[model samples]
Target: MEENQELEQELAMEDVLKNYDFKKIHTGEIIKGSVLKVTNDEVIVNINYFSDGIINKDELSFESDVNPFDVVKEGDEISVKIISTDDGEGNVVLSKKQADEASIWDSVDDAKKEGKTVVVKVKSETKGGLIASYKGLRVFIPGSQAAARRIELNTLVGQELEVKLTECDKVKKNIVASRRVIEEAEIEAKKNELWSGLTVGEKREGKVTRLAKFGAFVDIGGVEGLVHVSDLSWKRVNNPEEVVSVGDTVNVFIQSVDREKNRLSLALKDVATNPWTLVESKMKTGDVVEGKVLKFTTFGAFVEVADGVEGLVHLSEISDENIAKPSEVLEIGQTVKVKVLSIDAANHKMSLSIKDAVEKSKEYLQYTDNEEESTLGDLLKDKLSGVKFE
Candidate 1:
């Protein structure tokens, strides 16, 4: 009975030994553990070994003044490298910083292979480039790759930037990055989207950027469109400056878009407020209106009867006597009284007769002479009734 009892006890001890891990823990081996305790200067971790691991304040991070409690709390799982299998007190010595440095190079290599971007904090501006920190590693960004536009390098210090790694040499421990690559790609994407979504007759608000003799270039979003001088306003525009100046904010419509040729045309005149809409209500046939001669063509003269509205005086209607051309009897800017013979507002056209106007004036003069006892105002009012004058 004594022998059987001793054999049972030995079997139980073998089972207890089997439950514990007998794997040897060595220095330089990375392992994972749960934080068992956290103090101001040290962190105690449970690695399932007979003894707990301890990480001193200096091993918590690359920063010189970091506290152990700030980096980890109790029950938090962390990966650390074994600095020694046993310290003087029988606890495993661990370093979180060494483990991070060992794996950071692999992380950077993976990111580069996948064409992924990384976030870096600018530490300082160097002689030919910028020095930035990525997981405690120094990354070099050249001056030409710093930004898409001109910028002061010193201003970037202490700011975090997103960049693409262009070159990585593990042997030399060098990494080159660029922020301009990402910015330029984003700009090109926006330009392409703007071009694809555009349609003719879409209204947009833009700023005039440049003025030329034939047209003005306006920037709407990231794209530029040309506004021809002829399309600037309803009134005659001899120069683009007459309607819009550089740096002026204006509303425009897309007149035409040629994607193949990469040409865009814009119009500044508001079609809703076209002067032709006012022709029918402002004047009628046979009403004598005072107008200024605007321009002369081979057969007729264009006269401005109202703001932005012009009427044509044919050579036959210049005077009672026939003239070879309207310029023979009328000069540009000359004020004249003309009778409206026809109005085609839908077509933006009107016909005027200077001969008929002269006949009306003669009748008014005769009527005034017959009414000698009447006041001059009363005679003029009766003769001018129903006449629309500007």
Candidate 2:
């Protein structure tokens, strides 16, 4: 009976040892635990080990100064890394901050691979930029990368902004981000969407944003279409700003669209009521029209008889005498009378003749020696009879 009782006691001791081995936790191992107690400077965690774990205020978080009770309460389950199996005392030393930092770094790596944007809180300032804390990872945002336009860096203080990670280096513990990158990406997407719906001959309304020497840029929605100086008006447009000023809303016609290059050819001229259409009805051939010479070319001089209506007088028709150049007969802004010779409204062309305007009619007086046959002697005798041979 004594031998049997000894074996039973040994077996009971072996079962207890096996259970302890199954629940044993090693140092440097990360595990989850429930908070058993919270104090101002330390939190007691139960890791299912024989001894409970203690996380001091310094190990609670990455913050320089922190209170354990402020973050963790009793019965809160938190993951912690066991720093020491036994620190001379019976309690284990655990670090919740280290575990959190490791987890956040993994997320940052994933974000970098996925090309994702992250929201970070501005925590403090750095030398050349502001430091933001994402989860627990610190990201650096340069002053110039904070906005689409340059602004005061301190303006971002305490403001939460979304940013893309431009550089993420886990080995060097460096993370660089840009707020401008995210904004530009969003704008590009909207611009592409705006371009997709556009087609040739699409009528749209827009606001003039600015004028250039070559063209003007208008904001239709998200895209900016270029209105060249030539397209601003049917008449001559020496300057774009003269026709449309900045911030003016105007109706525009899309002449063509190049989707591959994101280019739109636009027009501001009349589509149905062209200024040239009224030229034939208002003036007829052979009618003398008063006009101002606007410009001179090698072939002729362009004269404006009415608003937006111009007629060309060929070099041969400028004068009855030969001329080497149109400038010899007409200067810019000089007023002259021109006889309309031909009109081609479909092609927006009009021909005029200045020499025809000053020509003599067919009944002009002439001088010749073809009088009647009454001789000078007969006339003399008649005068002698009337005057008594004076």
Residue lDDT tens for model 2, 183-279: 8888889888878878777789999998999988888887888988877887776789789999999888888888888788787776665778888
Name the best candidate (by TM-score): 2
Model 1 segments more than 4 A misplaced: 1-29, 34-39, 42-56, 82-94, 123-131, 142-159, 277-305, 309-390
Name the lDDT value of residue 258 in candidate 1: 89
C-alpha lDDT of all candidate models, in order: 0.89, 0.84
RMSD list, candidates in order: 8.5, 8.5
**Candidate 1 lDDT, tens digit per residue, 1-390?**
999999999999888667556485778999888999989889999887878899998998877898777788899998899999889999899998888877887888888999999999999999988999999888999999999888999999999999999988777889999999999998779878999998888899999999999999999887899999878988877889778888999999999998888789999998778888988898999899999999999888988898778889888888877677887788889999999999998987899988889899999988977777567779889999999978
Going through the candidates in the order shown, the clash numbers are: 0, 0
